[model samples]
Target: MAPPNLPFRLIRPAPDPVLAEAVLRLLETPEPASEALAELAMRDAPFTLALLSMRPLQPGEATTLKRALTERIDEAGDALLRAWLMHTGSQQLQADAVGQLNMRAGQVAETAMHLAIELRYPRPDEAYLAGLWHHVGALSLLASTRDFPVLRDQPATALERRQAERQRFGIDQIQLAAWLAESCGLPPTLRDALALAGAHEEHVAGAHPLARILRAAIHIAGPDATLDEAARLTGLDTERLSNLKTDVDYLSTEGLKSLGIGAPGAAEHERKPSGYPMLPSGWRAVALGGLLAGAFEGIDGKRLSLRLGNAFRLLFGKTPPLMLTVTEGQVQPLPMDTAQVAPHLITELGLQVDDDTSVVALALRTQASTSHFPGGDGPGRSTRDWHLARWLGTAGILCVPWQIEDTPGVAVVGLDEHLDLPTEEQQLMARLVSGAARALAAERTRRRAMDQLGETLMASQREHIRRVTHEIKSPLTVIKSYLGVIGQRHPEDPTLATELNQVSQEIDRVGRLLGQLAHPESATEEPRSTSVSGVVQELQHVYGEPLFGQRNRELEIRIPGGLPPVAIPASTLKQVLLNLVRNAAEALPEGHRLTISSPGVLITDGRHSLELELADNGPGIPEPRLHHLFEAAESSKGGEHQGLGLSIVKDLLGQFGSYIFCRTHPERGTRFNLFIPLAKPA
Candidate 1:
C-alpha cells in the first residue's frame, strides 16, 4: 500500500530568483496581513500574476475561508486578494497552452480546504495553501520538459505516477515539493502536509490531521472521485461528503476568482462578498418557530415584528431595529417603533396614498434592495443619499413591500441592516415576510367580513320590524272601529261602556309603537322620480288574487285622474302597497271589502302629491295587545305574525318624504292613509 519514490528527477542546485524571492517574502512574514498582500499584488502585476500562477482558484471557492476570517481579517483586503487571484489565474489558463496542471493545483487547494472544513481540520487556509503548492514541483518539471504532456496524459495510479516521474527526472514530484516547501520557509506542518500526498495507505491514516485531510482532498479531487469513495477515504457520511463536494466546487470557483487566478487583467476586479449570512446549523427551523409563535400571538402586530427581529439576530450576528409601516387604509407602525416619528412626519410623508419616490413606495414598486453607501450609513447623512435614511438611523435600511391578494393595503418594512443573503438565507427572510403578510391579510379579511355581516344583520332586523308593524296596524284599525261602534250603541250599559273605553285606550297605545322605527333627521335620503299609480296597479295585479281570494276579501283600488309621478322608486312603493294589502286581506274575514283610494293633494312645498287610503272590514284586535302593534316582534295575530308591516310602510314612505297614518271606527273596520310626494316636472 506504500507509494513508491520516483527514480529520476532533475535536482536544482540553485533556486530561481522569483521563486527565491517568494520564499524570502514568506520567511519575512510567516503570516502576512491580507491588506499587505493586496497592496503588494496591486503594486506589482507581474508578482501578482506569478503568485496566482502558483495555484488556481475556482469560482466561489473561498466562501468558507472568507467566513472563517471575517472577524479576523480586513474584508476589503481579503476581497482585493481574491479578485486579483481570480483575474490572474483565469487569464493565464485561457492564454497559456499548459495551464491544465496549474488549474489542477488550484483545484487541489480548493478541495483541501473543503475537506478541512468537513473533517474539522485546523488552520484550513494554511491547509489550502499547502495543497495548492504541493504540486508546484510537478508544474516546474512539466514547464522544463517539453514532452511532459505525454507523461501527464498517462492513465496511472499514484504509485505508478511517482515511479514514472522518478524514472524520467531522477526524483519524483513528492520529493521536489517537500524540498520547495522547506526552502520557502512554509511552516513544518504545511511542509509535512504536502509530503502526505505520497504516503502509504497505512501511513496516511496516522499522519498529521492537516496531512490526512489533504490526502483525502487529493484523492477526491481526481476525475473519478465519487461520494461513496470520498466517504470511505475521509470517514465522512454520504451527506457530509456531498456537502463537502458542493462547498469545494463553489469555494474553489470563487477562490480562483478571489485570488485573480483565471482572469489575467482582472486583478482590479471586485468580487462581491456573498451577501448571504452564514447561519449556524438548524437555524432555519428556529427562525420558523419564532415567526409562527409571533403570528399566533394575535393580530396586534407587535409579536410578529419582535419575532422577525429575533430571527434576524439569529441569522446575522446582531439584530437591528425594524420599522414596519402597517397599513389597512393608512400607514402607521406597530406600537413598538411608533415613537421614532411624529405627526409632522406623517403629514409630510402624506402616506395616505404614498409617494412614488419614497422609500416605502420604492420598496413596493421595485421589490429589490438599495442602500445609501458601500456600507449602510446612518440617518440624516444618507437621508439625501437614500430616502429610507429619513427614518432608519445610523444603520442601513432594507425595505420589502408585502401585500395580500384582494386587499387594498400593503405593509412596507424598513430594517436597520442588510438583508442581502444567499438564496437559502433570502428564502428565510422571505418566509418571515410572507408569514407576517399572510397573518395580517387574514386578520384584515376576517374583520372586514365581520363588519359586512353586522351591517347585513342590522338591515335585516330593521326590515323585520317594519313588516310586523304593517301587518298588525291593519287589524288594530279594525279593533278600534268595532270598539267605537260598540260605545256608540251602549251608552246606557256601564259594563259595555267600560270595555269600549279600555279598547280605545289600547288603540292609542298601539300608535306609539311606530316611535321605535323613527329615523334620525339625516336618514331621509333623496328619492328617485317614479310613477305612483303604476306601482299601485302593479302590486294589485300581483297580490290581489293570492291574498284576497283565499279569505273571500275583495280588493278595490280607486285613483283620481291625472295623478302625478311620485318621488320614490317603483319597487319601494310596490313593497309598501303589498304589505298593506296583505295585512288588509288577513284582517278581513269572508265577505269583507278592502278599498284603496288615491286622492290628489297639493302640499305647502308647491308639489302635487297624492294620498292613498286602504280600508278593511275585519274582527277587532284585543285592546291589551293593540298598543304594541308597530313594535318590533309585536303582533296582533300573536306569534303567527311579526308587527313589522306598517313599520315597513312608514320606513319606505319616509324615503320619499312621505308617511302613513291609521284610523278606525267600531264595527266600521280599519283604514290606513299613506301620503306620497310627486316628482317636479323636468
Candidate 2:
C-alpha cells in the first residue's frame, strides 16, 4: 500500500553489538537498578531514538535510505544501546508502580475503550485517548525526577496534587503531560483531554457520560477510596458497579504481567464486594454535629445561586420549582424565576405571623419530624394553619431558617402533594439550605466592597483624563486663534490663506475631541427646550448639499409641517444628527440614499414624546458586531476611525432623555428610531 515516491523508511534497524550487550546486561539482572537506568534515560535524545528504532524506521528522504542499516547502527551504537536498555527498564518499572496503584489506570486506554463499547457510547477512540493520556504528566514527572514519588504520600485532591507538584517543580503534571503529548506528535484532542484533570468541579450537574466514566475509573483505582464513595460519585448502583470493579482488578493484574512485573498478591486481600457503607451507629449525631460546628466550605460570589440550586438537586434528587427567601416581612424569590406567586400572596402570609412565632411558621426548622394534617385538630393548631391550608392547597409546608451573623432569614421549599419526605432527609436539607444562605451573605458583602473600590478607581481615572486634556487644549486653542487672524489679514495671498484655514480646522477638530473625552458626563445632563422642526430645517440648510455632493448620494429629509418643540437644544440636536448623517453617508454605496422621515406618533406616559426614524440604503452591520455597536472601543470601520462616533452619539442622546433603537439586516439595509420627548404646551 506504500506509495512508490514516498521516501520515509518503515523498517527498524538492528542494535549494534555494544548496544545489544547493554540490553542483555539489563535483562540478565533480577531487577535492574531504577536509579542507574533513570540516570541514563535523562539523556533524552538517544533514548527517544532507540524507542523510535523499535518501530518501523523512516529515513524520510531517498538519499538517507541509500545508506546501509549497519552504517547507521555503527555510528552511534554504544551510546544508543545503553540509552535504549535503560529506557526500556525504567518504563517497565514505572508501568509496574502505576499498575500497582490502579490496574485500570495503568492500562487506561484499552480499558476505557472496552467500557465505552459495552456502554454503547460513541467515539471509543476519543475516550481511550482521554483516559490513556490523563495521567501522563505524573508518569513523565516520575521518569525525570526521583523525588516525585514522595508526593504520592500527600493526601490531596487531583487539583491539590497538581498545585503541590507545581510548587516543588517549575511545572505541574498537567503541563508536563501536555508537553510530552505534543513532543510525541499526539493530536490536540489528546492534549486537551489531559489538561481537563479537574474539570468535574465545573460541570457537576450535567456532565457528559464520558467525563463521568473517566472520573469514576480514576477514583475507584485511587488509594484510600472506598467502593461506596466512588459509586455515589459515578451514579453507578452496586449491581452494575460490582462488574466494573471485577473487570478493573483482572485487567490491571494482566497489564502488570505483560510489562514483566510480578502481580501484587496483597491486592486480593483488599478486595470487597460492592455495597454502600454500613451506617455508623451515631451517623446522624456525627453529621448534624459537624454541620452545627460550621465545617462547610464557601463558594465564589458570582455562582452563589447556581451552587445553591445544585445543592438542592443533591438533597431532593430534583430541583424545587420555587425557593423564596423571607426577610423583614417580605418574600423575595431567587432571580432564576420571578413568576412563582403574586405580591399579594406574600403580603398575606407575612401578616399572619409575628417575630416570636416565625420559626414555627416554617415547619422543618429543627431536625424533628412534625407535620400539620389538614383536619388533625393538633395540640398547637392556629388560625394561620387554616389560612395556609386553604390558600396554598397543601396539608403541610416545610421551611428551614438560616441566620448569617444573627440576621434571621427563612427558606421556603415548595413541594408537590405526592411527595412525603422523612425527618432524616429534612435535617440534611436544612444543613444544605443553611450553607447556601451563609455563602450568599458572604458574596453580597464582598460585592459591596468591590463596588466601592471600582467607584473610587473610576473617579480617579476621570480626574486624570480631565487634567491631561486641559493641558493639551490650552496651547491648541491659542494656536488656532493666531491661525485664524493670519488667514483674515492675508486674504490676498491665496496659498498662505488656504494653508492657515486648513490648520485652524485641524485645531478645531482636536479641540472638539478633547472636549468629548474630558467631559463625557456633560453629554448625559438635562437638555434645553428647542424646536424639533427648527433643528431639522437647520440641518437641511447647513449640511444637505455638502454631505450628498461628495458621496454622490441623495439626502432626503421628510418632516411634517407644524410639529411641536421637543426638549433638546439646537446645538445638541445638531451634533446628534451630524454624527448620524455622517455615519449613514460613509456606510452608503455610490447609488445608495439616506432618508430621515418622521411618522409623528406621540408616546405618552406622564408626558408626550415624539418618534423619528432615519433610514439608509447600505450593507447592514455585521451580526457579530451589531450588539456592541454603541459600546466604545468596538468597531467595524477599518480605517482612521477609532469607534467613538456612535458611542459619543449615544451619550449625547441620553442627555435629552431620548434613545435610539437600531434595526438591520443584509437585505433590509438599516433603520434607527430616535425617540424624543415633546415640550409641554405653553
Q: What tens-digit string does per-residue lDDT give for candidate 2 at 154-203? A: 78876787778777775676776556445444455445555555666456
Please state the error at residue 472 of candidate 1 in Å: 2.7
User: In model 2, where do residues sit more than 4 Å from their true spots?
Assistant: 1-277, 281-381, 384-393, 398-423, 472-533, 536-572, 583-640, 644-682
Task: State, as a TM-score between 0 and 1, how close model 1 is to the true structure.
Answer: 0.28
lDDT string, candidate 1, 1-682, tens digits: 1112332222111122222233335324656565444433322223322333222233333233333232222322222232222222222221232344455566667778778776777567776766667667766565445545577669998689888877776667787777656543456777787777777767877777777777777766665665664566678887876677666766655655544344211222332221123245356445443544343335444544444443333232123333345365455543442234443554455454345435554554455543333253334332322533445443345454444564322233333334343444344454555565566556667778999999999888878877887787788889889888888887899866765665475465454444346322334443577776777675665567778865677988787657778778765676688788887787787898888887667573565667788887766555554565555656657766868887777777876788777777667788778777777778
What would the TM-scores of all predictions be? 0.28, 0.40
Output the number of the TM-score-best candidate.
Answer: 2
What local lDDT does model 2 show for residue 302? 36
In lDDT terms, how accurate is model 2?
0.55
